[model samples]
Target: MSVKIEKAYILKSFVINESDRVISVLNEKGEKISLVAKGGNRLKSRFQGKLEPFSFVKVEYFDRGKGGLNSLNNVELLENLQKWIKGDMKKFFALSFLNEVTDRFVYEKERNSKIFRLIKHVIDSLKDGVDLKLAISYFSIWMLKLSGVLSEFNEEIQCLNEILAKPLDKLDCKEPQTIFNFGLDLISKNSDKPLSSADMLKNLI
Candidate 1:
């Protein structure tokens, strides 16, 4: 079988036996696929440190065509994502959440350009020193936007701004849930339109 080399981001990994690993990778095709990297968990493994979760690498594998599991041929190093993972605990936790969610959103060989870029952008941003709190919120908005849960926010955005202008201690003095529900309602109402990243950021302030 001729092997197909795909550059992918490792989203999740599970130890298979004691030597190999089963990984879910998100490829540039915006698809998530599974592969078994034989002998991937040893001191001198074929995959080495490249198969760790959230690593981005050039992966060589043979597509089995039956959609069960692709056979990995060889692996190449690209970005290990160690900078982000090894630096900040909060960002690392956020990465785990995003990785798992992205895995669920993308299916086997299913392409989605927006979803692909959104994830890549957020990961890259984290690598570039984005605040963890803000990064997580930004990531959520972007992912929801990609997943069609964020739409245009003209009406709600205006209300949000107006509502936010009031001193927190004065507004409603009674229900925190109302503000939370307001944001949810807006998200539900505008999830189909193109959501603005700037507007989402503004909502954070």
Candidate 2:
């Protein structure tokens, strides 16, 4: 087995047994990786509090090549957004929507640095208290753009160009709700399955 270390954002985690967990993360390379954390569910486990979703961490794992799960060895937390987001329902559901959209669009072992940077930037913006509408709108537009399906809607909306030109933290739109809905509709249309968090976000809004 080979050892690999990567800086990644914890996308989600699943408890597989009484003492183990399966973690899904989007690494710096923009690749989605699954790692098996043994004893992760135990009270005193090394990975106990380090594997929470939306955390930025440095992880070391054993790569067993193909046909076997990667075994997690260690994790060092870099940032955790749960504390900032969990208190507010709107923030929580909005982040949930973002997480679901990222999970849906990103494929295993495929590297797309643009998407990676986009997610990182959005997360930082959210941490700094940027408007939820602007953050989601920016992420949705960029995801569609990077996926190469954005051209279909470009001619219809001139303002998309303006939005694209601005940075995530600098983005400002007079009609943020309209832009957000437009992007959301396009994202839903292109997705293979309807986003489960979409309804939750809508209700919170």
Candidate number achieving the greatest TM-score relative to the actual structure:
2
What 10-residue stretch in candidate 2 is worst by lDDT?
150-159
* Candidate 1 per-residue C-alpha lDDT over 29-147 given as tens digits, one digit per residue, 9 for 90 to 100: 78788999888878888677778887888889988877568988888878777674667555556676567567655667778766666678767766676544444444454555566
- CA lDDT for candidate 2: 0.85
Lowest summed lDDT window (length 10), candidate 1 = 167-176
lDDT of 1: 0.64
TM-score for candidate 2, residues paired by index: 0.94
Per-candidate local distance difference test: 0.64, 0.85
Q: Residue 73 in model 1: shift from native, Å?
A: 0.9
